[model samples]
Target: MSTIQRPSRPCKECQRRKLRCDAQQPKCGLCQRARVPCEASPAGKRGPKRGHLDALRNRLVQLEETLQNRLDSEQHPQEHAQALHYSPGSTDASQSTDFLRGDVGYGDPLPQAFMLPGPSMAGDADTLGLGPFPFPDLAVSLPQIDRGTHAELDQLYFDRVHPSFPILHKRRYLNWSKSTAKSRSQTCLQQVMWILATLLSTQSRDLINPLYSRVKQDIDLIIMDTGPCQLELVQAWTLLTVCELMRALYGQAWASAGRMFRLLQGLRYHEIDSPRKDPVASEGMIDPIRTEEKRRVFWMAFLIDHLLSIRNRWPICTRLPISDHAFQAAQLGSSTFLSQAVTEPPSSDTCSFNECIIIATLSGRGLLRDVHGTISEAYGGSGQIHIDHDEWLNLVLATRNQALRQRNDSDRMGTFAQILGQVTEILFCKSLMTMNKNSSTESCTQEYRCRVLRAAEKIVLFAADLTALHFSMVHPFMFIPLFVTAEFLYENRALGDGAFLTQLRSLVDVFGQLTNVNDHERSYLDLLSRSCQQNIAIMPATTCVELKRIARDFLEALEDPNDPTKAQAVASADLSVTHESYPSTEGLEQFLSGWAKAKQFMPNFRMELVDMVAEVDASGSGGKVWVFSKVTGGGGGTDRDSIDMMSINGEGKVWKTKDVQRITSKH
Candidate 1:
């Protein structure tokens, strides 16, 4: 250099002395003065060392190798099953080091073809393999269940799940699943469907945990990366909601259902009756099968929204249209709802799906849950504290009857529908009973109690039929109905005949069967069963028989309700309606007075026992309850139901004054 520019970096000797560098490099003042040999350069390199890229490259190489193995396995997928479905492998967290770093899983000996590797990031992120969504790794994490396990699951799904929920088209889905190729969204669908199948098949947390966790981890990324307009995505989301419910992930289930509903709105599925050329009409070309699928898909979301509301008593995401015809048509096409839903469509069992819709709508409209302050406001309700009980009962029965009219010759779907319909009726009946517990007449209270018992019994018997047929045929939603029935039975067990505890325990046994699928159900079942066993009281056979005798005699006394003298003679010993004049059945006593009053107000009144409950007393003290469905003569067949509960002390042989509770005016 011309003047030997002063070196900016210090020499080794200067650094050791912690002094400034001199103008020259060969000899420095600090080294010379300290009598230390000076080094030519500094102790370290000119710049900081870089070890990050090296470590990253090593990781990249590992991923590439594992991906290559997966690729090789995918080519020969039939040979992929080197071991049985997830061979008993160690799931111990301490052995996690043995786990793969990708979607293959923690400790499962899963087939390598489950996961496929995405393209490596090139020079630019814009050119990444993920189409229109720069998330190159989103689709890669999806794990396609192995062919063998998938085949088993496919059979299981169509055989068991499909009968209850026939949302997917069978032949098309089977063909698609069998093929080696699937789009990004279809891949997502496969993964979620597999997750549901796994949960339904095995109770082993070992298998469910890994697959479920992987889906949960990658599914959000896929949904976010691949925007949610696809029908397959909607189906996947719905299935995921079911999965969350099975595992008792309530919060997550709610969120998943909510997201799916929004996706549905985005796809414009909610505009069922819109005049505009909506998403279904693409440039004046309509796909019939696809359109039917869209309707089923929308109805599926509708079903979930209502189920969520029913299960937790929460506000539904999408409010039902005020129009009944529109709502029913939207649920199942007008033609389908009329022909298939009511009569039996050769094409599909839409009645089952419509039946579920009916229950969902009933729960919200009937206001079964205690938390209806906000929900009431949404649907033009007065948002008042006291619900109009008559209006509530009317809505309930109307919905129930409409759903009941849905007939399927095949019980595969019909059984589930019947169970749900009865379950809903039971829920509404219980709510009515609870509302009128103390302030109302004993007879009125007992009428609702009888209704509750009848509905509960029907549900248990239907579930019994399902169990007998095959538990797999039961809907996944059956779990909710089962719990609801069990709880209602226990709460109102004292209202039953001598068979009170018998019915309750029958449902308890069904609860235990849920353990065959998983243990979560057993936890709640134990709590309910324990409570029932500890507190439940069974009515005595004598009291039940006596009450039945009293009911029969009362009906016999009023055999000619039209005749005044016969009505007056109801309490006579000759009539045998009440054997002992000292302890007369109140039903017999009220006959003359009610008939006389009926003649006074509206002439020629006719009455019969539409429904009856013999034993209303848990102490077996002999309390009589009967539900009289009133039919007004000469008035165009106006059908209505009422309850006349009579309080009688069998032990003391004394009659107490009771009032009539008119439950519903008309169906």
Candidate 2:
């Protein structure tokens, strides 16, 4: 069947070789002779052939155009607004574009998606750019450190500080540190690291003070400089806050933490991803390593804010928008990535340490959340509300269980976890104390006292144990637990036993040994020492009368001797096991006159002598008197001692008098 006569073309091979071709149907004659199958090129294809370099160049051109368009829109917003208003809204193909454009108005100037290096880029600083991060215009400049000093400081930081807080990525940081052309972000971070290392490693104020000043100046310069917040800068501020905390500069630390919180929110680190309608799908395509590091930084910021809030006794500034489940999922994903990335298996110590930190961080979040709730309930909103003790206790127990479940062989982390658990317990107990401070029922009052004493005991025991093991490893910032315990013991002198006293002395010694203890900490130590001695002195007084007498005598001794009324003899008599002679009515009258004179001179020295049996009769000649028992010891009426009182009418008034026989006579 003769098909329509077909137009013929040369085979592709013949055309490529540029040989003249005789029109053929199936194959050219040359291809047939050569025994080669031939094909013809398709018609109507007309475009420049694209190579790898050409494709890359095209992408670069496209990016440049896009950047220029963005800059132009920013520079001339009215034009952009006009364009947006004129654009068609109903086109199916334009829907995605419209949605993206909507986000452009609300999007952060420096989106978090651009914070980390891409998968192809190995280093963050290199990926960002080697130029100085633009800071606000400032006259002060950052000091530069030599490579050797930088390396030494880095090593010191990783060895001492990073072990406790592994916020920085070891491999990534090491790689960045080796770069010759460091950015301002990198310089700020290095300075903070040096400051922390020097602060922890040295007790010499002369050395650390200068280093701290230079670091602070650098931080100030960086903060004042104008640029989009970078991850490195966030990290620098985080470390700087930590350094401030180590120095017991709580106000400064809190302020720095607030700044860090703002920066983190600016970066949208508070959210797992942007809440914009047109979220970037490329975020999911980021390198797992970089994603993991970002997750770590976010959690670190979260933890720092929570811890600072707890320390400052304020509400947490940042709300955790991400759920715990999501956090756990991210943690698991990062762990999987780490496992895949490491060629050699991690040591058990390393695994345990990492697990301990992770578990502690998670549990600490829960604990801090409950603490915030308690604080809010008690002190926020309207007025003080009743703390649900059982609910708070259950929360503490749950957190403690979670922490203990993840405990490992690492002593430092394990002890720290335990200490945190005890701290939570103490906080809960303290909340109850605050709520029940003015409770009307005696049972409630007794329950509150018992709970407080128990919490105090637990705190002291946990702190003593922690101090015994790797005390030097304990951060001075952690001494809050000890401080709380000391205050409790001081207030409730009956709770301090010989063992507790000994442990308290040991804690003071540990505080002394800490290289990072600032003047605040030293002052706390001194106060704790004096409180411990005072409590120890009252330890021997078993009866309520003896306790009261000792306390009164101590207080009286502290009076200003220059005052005529306070010029009584310093009572050297041991009230623990001594009985004095009782005075006659005339002698008692003289003592009453002296007591009244003392009260007038010292407004703070009002003493109410209560009779244990019945109310003293004040009905004599238009005068009134009442007697009540005074219990100096804490807890529920365990040790009761009573002293009698008398009231005499003088100058149309009742003068309260203490019966000498009732005080000196054994009950």
Candidate 3:
């Protein structure tokens, strides 16, 4: 009975082309001629189209209904008995509520207010084949260590790991451990501590996977439940991240770091207020110990986030949100506490490990923040950023001085800080090199190269000394220095400097110790060792003597004849270089041309004549116009034969040169 709608006008394309249309079924005659399909205008809508507003309105209505239902259930549970029914496995409601409020309970379910997903509905056939959802079973059983073993591991952690991190309050933690039965949070922490201690003390991965999985599972449950992000929870997760990093599970470590970052944010730890004035604490209760602990935990999170950001090449997440005054106030408060503790009358059993750790942490934080800021400023601009060489050098020197001071004052902790400082210098130098590589106005100069090589040498010698001292329970931070030094040595081996080759061998030896604990370490060692072997394969016989000597020293240091890889490196080093030969003047010219094209020729390019040869025709009518010989004279470790020959056309032009085995004979 309704009037029919009229057809719409033709499409814009046909109109634009000024084409006449017979407006056929799917195509017009003009469009058909042009081999383009005709598309008609869409029919006009009678009303406005549905869009985001409509969807939002629908969602709001559903939420309103849900709220109404929830209120009704609260008012009269009998009205929605089936909906509010508790499963047999669920804990008492009061217990769940108390646990949600952060009271100690192991079996309580998360409060309903948190809005976590419930267990799968058995009565619903829709989700029958999807399998059980994660986090339904929050219960986890952890492996228990004996009392003696626990104490030993705790001591091990304090002795080795605590000096570097020092976030945990040993006395308070020990007292708490003795006073209370283990809670879920405490259990998770214990597992993490044990895993770290074992790794540091034994350098063994026997307990790593199982313990790591257990802690991970617990963390997942806590996150899913939207549980209170307590300090203990934060510490547990932070340690878990460290453990992941130690195992070279970078992706997993990064994920853990992200979660830790969010957890700290949820706790408002980044607000940077004096702990005594923390708004989240009770109105009148200002527990200085708790305040200090919170500050320590926050700083730890900041440090971890910064390191992860650098490692992952992502933007840092721990940017201070509060004013400078607040940050200084927080730092000052911690420093005051540390100073008071250290200046107190010393007992025979008193240990200043805690104070040393706090000072070192504070110093390291300041240094790292400065480095991060400098780098960000250097690279944050739109165009090319030119580094002030003097300014850069001063910064490096200052960092080095700080590290040396840290190293000179204390024992292992100082040593740790010292190594970190050295690594910082190496990182800065590397940054400069990278900037130079990418700079339009500036290129890598000899001075910068020398700085990098010097930094690398320092790192290598320090690592070698540390390894020789058997202080090889090396922390995760040390890995960067080791890896970077190896990379620098490998890439610059063409310099033909015996010292560079020697350091490279030493780095390889240091890596051998690390390979047993991490797959990444093992992989890196293998790759670098192979690279060294490859360089050795093409090295000139004249340069082989020093490299062979270095290789023998490294092999002897290994003290294990069964290590096939080290033995193979020794054998590769022992390979005799074949006789060298020099090319004719024509070949030299050809080499120069190719070298220019490759951009391999530097301003200081030096060519050493290793060999020369000449041949004459039997009739003596044709002179020696072509020559082939080996030459090695680049700063970077390239050694190859080259060909020099005169033009076959007899134009009498300059001699031409090409790389070994590349150019073919024309006649």
Candidate number of the best TM-score:
1
Order the candidates by TM-score, highest first. 1, 3, 2
Q: Candidate 1's residue-wise lDDT over 318-356, tens digit each? A: 212222223323342233332123223223334445656
Lowest lDDT sum, 10 consecutive residues, model 3, at 646-655
- The weakest ten consecutive residues by lDDT in model 2 span 570-579
The better candidate by TM-score, 1 or 3, is 1
Model 2 lDDT on a 0 to 1 scale: 0.47
Better of 1 and 2 by TM-score: 1
- Candidate with the greatest lDDT versus the true structure: 1
Candidate 2, residues 26-114, lDDT tens digits: the string is: 66666676565667744643664335356557656766765565544456545433332212344345434543443322123433232
Better of 2 and 3 by lDDT: 3
Task: Output the TM-score of candidate 2.
Answer: 0.48
Clashing pairs in 2: 134-226, 135-225, 135-226, 136-224, 136-225, 136-226, 610-628, 618-623, 618-624, 618-625
